[model samples]
Target: MSTGFIILALITIAGAIGAMNCGRLVHCALSLVASFAGLAGIYLQLNVWFVGVAQILVYVGAVAILIVVALLVTRNAESDRQNEGSKGWIAGGSVALLVFILLAGALSNTAVTGAATLAPDSSVETIGRRMMTLYVIPLEALALLLTAALLGAVVIALGGPKPGRASK
Candidate 1:
């Protein structure tokens, strides 16, 4: 592996660990962003330009920022953390180990078949055209869905009726 790939992998692993172990929601969100960015860099290094850019744009740009903003707006992150006292680490670890063993056994029994490769036909333009023409409705629906979700988050954060407002 290249030095750049090794660096990116290390960053990704560190960020993932921080995201999972950090006590504060804001710190965890920031660590998740670091992990997303490092994965994007690794994708770019692997020459998958579209996926890398999409990772950076959609994950790092949109999702992580939205999470941070939502956490800030709610302003109850610490209180929730206090409420969630014990995290049952032993049970979680045991389940994870069980799943890993099952997956390893399954993979060990699977046969690898080598197939002839086909020429590359997917370009950025083709993907863009497909998105604009074939999948526009789904795309617009997803945008509307995300907008509704954002509005819902804001409403929840506001804690219902305000002091000067009347409820119907």
Candidate 2:
């Protein structure tokens, strides 16, 4: 693995850990954004420009903002600090570790990877042309939907009661 890849991986892992352990929902969402950015950087380093740009645009930009907005609009965030460290984390951690181990073993035993594959002649221009010519409608619809959802979340969050103890 390259040094840049190693750095990106460390950032990704650290962001993931932060997201999982954060006491506040907003912090978690931001950490997730960091993780997404790190992944995007890794994609860029791999020369998969389309996927890297998509990762930044779709995940880091839209999805992360949506998550933060949703968290802001939710009642759970009001009691964020109350649930800092859950007791069930140990069980969850153990299960996650088991899954990781199993996945590692399965991947090691697979013939999925060997010689590196040469990439096709993919470029930003071709991807843009395809999106504009063939997939324009779907892309526009998705943009509209995401915009509406973001607006709705902002409205809800802005109009909600101030952060305080939940009413009995």
Candidate 3:
């Protein structure tokens, strides 16, 4: 691997570890942005420009921002919540071990069928045209769905209007 790729991979791993271990929601969200940015850099280095930009825009820009906003909005609600200890660690570890074993077995059985090949033309223009002509509706629907989901999460976290409670 190139030195640049190695650097970006290290950054990605560091960011992911920071995000996973962080106790504060804001810190975790920022760490996720760092991870996404490194991933975007890797994608750009691979010449998949569309995916790279989408990674930055969608994950770093939108998702991270939404997470921070949610953290702020629910900060008070979460203050009173008790941390659940590693109650499910045994079950979680078992599931993770099973998944790892399954993946390892499957990968061990797979064989390389062909040499690696790069696409001749994977430019932004071609991707834009395809997105506009073929995948516009699905893409728009996805955007709407994500927005709805974010709003729902925020509302639920804020404990929006208890059932049968009269609103002012």
Candidate 4:
């Protein structure tokens, strides 16, 4: 593996660990941003520029912002710690172990194959054209969806309309 790839992978892993283990939800969301950034770097290093851009746009920009907004909007002054017991840890560990075993088995059985590779410039241009033409509807729909989500988050943050107040 390349040194850049190794570094990106470490960033991804460390961010994921920090996100999982952080005590505060906002810190976890920030760590998730780092993880998403590392994944974007990995995609860029692999020469899939569109996917890398989408990774940054979707995960880092939209999702992480949404998470932080939700956390902030719903947070309480009281400590949010939960007293998780040993059984919870044991169950979580077992589930993680099972998932790891399943993933390892699937990866070990997969075969790598060579596929046709295109120039990055031409690929990006083709993608852009398609996005403007064939995929325009879906892209617009996604934008609308994100807008609605943001509006909903704002409404939630404002605790919805007052129960007994008249309309302005």
Model 1 per-residue lDDT tens digits across residues 12-118: 99999899878777889999999999999998876678888999999999999889888887786355465444567677879989999999999999996856455
Query: Candidate 1 vs. truth: CA RMSD?
Result: 3.9
Which scores greater on lDDT, model 2 or model 3?
Answer: 2
Model 3: per-residue lDDT, tens digit, 38-94?
A: 999999988888889999998999888888887787787565344746757677869
Clashing pairs in 4: none
List clashing residue pairs in candidate 2.
none
Q: Against the true structure, candidate 2 has what lDDT?
A: 0.87
Q: Which candidate tops TM-score?
A: 4
lDDT of each: 0.86, 0.87, 0.85, 0.87
Give each model a TM-score.
Answer: 0.70, 0.71, 0.72, 0.74
Q: Write the per-residue lDDT of candidate 2 for residues 121-164, one digit (tens) a residue.
A: 56988888998999999999999998998899789856866567
User: Which stretch of 10 consecutive residues in model 3 shows the poorest summed lDDT?
Assistant: 76-85
* 1 or 4, greater by lDDT: 4
User: Candidate 3: lDDT over CA atoms?
Assistant: 0.85
- Tens-place lDDT per residue, model 4, 10-123, is 999999998987877778899999999999999998888889999999999988998887787788876455455779768998999999999999988999675757645647
Candidate 4: deviation at residue 3, Å? 2.1
Candidate 2 TM-score, true structure as reference: 0.71
Q: Which stretches of candidate 4 lie over 4 Å from their true place?
A: 115-124, 151-168
